[model samples]
Target: MRRWLVLGALLVLVLLVLAPFALIVLNAVKTPQEYAGSGPLSWPSHVSLDGIRAFWTRVDFGRKLWNSAVISGAVAVLGVLFSLLNAYALGIGRIRGRHWVLAAFLLANLVPQEALIYPLYYLARQVDLYDTRLAIVIVFTAIQSAFGTFLLTGVLAEFPPELLDAAAIDGAGRLRTLVRVVAPVSRPTLGVLGTFFFVWTWNELFIPLIFLISNDRQTVPVALGVLQGDRMMDATATSASALLGIAPAVLFFLVFQRTLTRGVTAGALK
Candidate 1:
């Protein structure tokens, strides 16, 4: 009875999570007139691609998508690389005050981006990086690295000591052991960090809105915000753009789904 109840609760939670996305997909196919006439939850009588067409033609979607891809991709790759090194040093190396270092990383993660945006903006402007993709990429990488270090630290800490011992006995130094041995074993954890950073950066709007003053330079989330205001009366176009904005993140999650699961569950047995 307890197991059945748990399963039923999970089913409800899943439905609650997926309900909004289902509405977006359903409404995205409707014509603007039909969408406005019918409710957002109502199914369309006939499918139309007009909303999707308008989303592409009426907006600089390709450029926005490319900008988002560049920023998110850079953040994911650079953030993971920095986090791995930080975790290795703190989690595996014989360093003094490593616990305090880990605590600092966790504290950095706790500091909300909203609280630091003003300082970051001032610093970016002072450095002549304001309103540039490079600025956002640097900010995203730093923010994501904090959380990544927090996660990867635990994973690296749980790594078998014997493996490192074996590598050392084979005349492999710290860098070579990390590259040839530790990295191969930590692929699942790395996948989780990369997917998380990519999706977070992809969906971020506030920071980009504050920094990227030009519409042409903004990310997809900022572009979608602009689209929402411009197409307030056109529900179908809004739905279409929202769906388009999230598709890449969804696809990325699907591709790395297994690895993410493995990475999250790895510490359970240890």
Candidate 2:
């Protein structure tokens, strides 16, 4: 009886989570007139690609997708690399005040992005990086690295001491052990970190909006925001754009779902 009740609750939770996405997919294929006339929850009478086509053409979605991919990919790769180095130094190395360093990284992650925007903006202007993709890439890399370090630190701290000793006995240098031994064992954690950084950077709007002033340089989230007018009424197009915006992150998660589960579970087991 208890197991049945738990399964029932989970089924309800899944429905609640999927409801909005189901609505978006349903309305994305409907004509604007049809969508406005029908209830949002109602199914389309006939499927058509008109709405999505219009959104793609008007928003130049392909270009926005390319820009977002480049920025998010760079942020993910660099963030994971920097985080691994920091984690190796703090978690595995014989460093002083390592606990304090980990605490600092956690505290940095807790700082809200809103509070730092002004200083970042000023710094960007001074450095002449304003309105550039590189600016977003650099900022996101730093921001995500904090959280990545927090996660990877915990994973690396649980590494078997015997293995490290053995590697040392084998005359493996710190860099070599990190590259050959630590990295291979930490691939699962790396996948989780990279996926998270990619998704967050892909969906970020505020920083990109403020820093990437040029339309061509804007990411998918910021580009979608531009489509909204004071009295925006194109429901179908809006839905289509939103679906497109989330698609990449959704696909990324789906692809790495197993690795993410393994990474989280590995940390917990350790």
**Best candidate according to TM-score:** 2
Model 2: per-residue Cα lDDT at residue 215? 73
TM-score per candidate, chains pooled: 0.92, 0.95
Per-residue CA lDDT of model 1 for 1-270, tens digit only, reads 999999999999999999999999999999877877878877899999888888977778899989999999999999999999999998898479988888898899899889999999999999999999999999989899989988888878888999999999999999999999998889878988898899999999899989998878988999888767664537788889988998989998998899899988866755
Q: How far is candidate 1 from the true structure (C-alpha RMSD, Å)?
A: 1.9
Write candidate 2's Cα lDDT for 142-211 as tens digits.
9999999888887789899888898999999999999989999899889889998999999898899899
- Superposed on all Cα atoms, the candidates' RMSDs to the truth, in angstroms, are 1.9, 1.5
Residue pairs with clashing backbones, model 1: none
lDDT of each prediction vs. the true structure?
0.89, 0.89
